[model samples]
Target: MAKMQRNTVLVVLSFFAIYFIWGSTYLWNKIAVTELPAFMLAGIRFVIAGSLIFIISKILGFSLKITKQQFKNTILAGFLFLTFGNGVVVWALKFVDSGFAALEVSAQPLVVLLMMRVFQGKKIQPMSIVGVILGITGIFLLVGQKEIIAQDGAILGMVLIFVCMLSWSYGSLFVGNADLPKNFFVNTGYQMLTSGISLLIISTLFGEQWISPIDWSIPVITSMLLLIIFGSIVTFTAFNYLLRIVSPEKVATSSYVNPIIAMILGWYFLNEDITAQSAIASVVLLTGVYFINTKKSLTIFSRFSGKRIPKDPVG
Candidate 1:
């Protein structure tokens, strides 16, 4: 009973960490990018975070032993997660407001549904397909409320960021399918180190030099460290572990939560304008999450394959 209670507490606390802290990353990117270039900041963040994870894991006696095949898989996963997913998100912060950026990335599960159908041969349910459509519509509506639209570089950046979210979704699915290490720390450390190195190389090729003009004061350093610790290590590592403990639907709830935090932080700190449109769109998006992540609804499509899902309201 005590062990169960302890686990329940841990899971609940982890959800708070991922939903709230990861939610605030958009704002963190906004703050960091004020004077520094986006890619450079991201490259540095990952390298530092990876180093910390690696060092700590070694201290904890975690060994990252992998066969040659797994090494190849790690590289592919790293490309998807680090190169495409995070790389573009950090760049997008250079263009869009963090709140709007968070809302845009919230469309990930819809992308994942389609990707699953394509790659994993997983059948998507009809109602869930409708949910995806509604979620996408909500995203478009949310974007309609955007205060500004940068045409050239900024618009391209937004497109890339959207693609980044898709890549992350696809990468996560692939990682789940792949033969992986049993130890989370070992696997996570390997991923961070390898991927961070790739990011460093990419940033260097793109001339992402560190800014001496940018504030490197104690507070700035502290903020960046918090992002590495809370945003990267805590939220992401906890999130990876959450799948073992809870329903994916419950895990998917963070999609809605991230944007809510982003918007509230915007209002509190950056003072971005928001409206009824955002509220309505956000609610509709979350309802879509409910339909998409519910396991029974997914099983109906998989078990029956072709027959229409029964109009059982319980599902």
Candidate 2:
């Protein structure tokens, strides 16, 4: 009984960290950008974080041996995670605010659902289709206004951001499908190292200036450190820990929790200027997400609530 209770407590704590701390990362991203160029900052942050994890793994007696195929997949995963997923978010900040970027990026699960059908021939529920329609419609409204349309040239940035999200979705799918290393810690460390280095090399090619030394301030450095330490390491560690101890359904639910925190923090800290449209879109997005992810369960819930539920794994 005591062991069971302890396990439950750890699971709750893990969920809390994912829900709140991860949500706040968008605000952190906004602040960090004040001092660092997106890609350069990403490169430095992930590289250091990855190196620390790798070194720690070595000290902990983790095996570094990996099959050639595993190494190749890791690099591909790295590209998706750091390059497309994170890289797009970094670059988009120049054209769109971090809060919006966060909202936009939060739509990853939706993109994944659609992509699964197209790429893997997986079945998608009808509710999922409607939920996606509502979700995508909301996004289109957010980005298609006169003022917003003026930012259309930033459509390139938008496209990059979506591509990044798709990359993350695909990488996540691959991680679950691949021949993961004997030690997950070893695999994670290698992935992070690859991702970090990939960012550094790519950023350099794009001429992301590495030395913005003049712009560094206490807040900037602090935010960068937080991302490197807490966002990448602590939260990630907690997430993996949860996966080890719980059902994926229980662990996977964090996808729903992160965005609410992101939305609240974005408004509170970044002053991302949420309007009526944004608010409506957010509500609709949330509704769609709730229905989409819980469609099967909510079909049951609707019986209890005497109301219809919308659709799975929404943004």
| lDDT measured at residue 299 in model 1 versus the true structure, 0 to 100 | 54
**Model 2 TM-score on a 0 to 1 scale:** 0.84
Error of 1 at 159 (Å): 0.8
Clashing pairs in 1: none
Q: State every prediction's TM-score relative to the real structure.
A: 0.86, 0.84
Q: Tens digits of per-residue lDDT for model 1 on 97-119? A: 77777877776667767777887
Measured by TM-score, how close is model 1 to the native structure?
0.86
Kindly report which residue stretches of model 1 are placed more than 4 angstroms away from their true locations once superposed: 1-6, 150-154, 212-219, 297-315
lDDT of 2 at 31: 79
Stretch of 10 with least lDDT, candidate 2 = 306-315
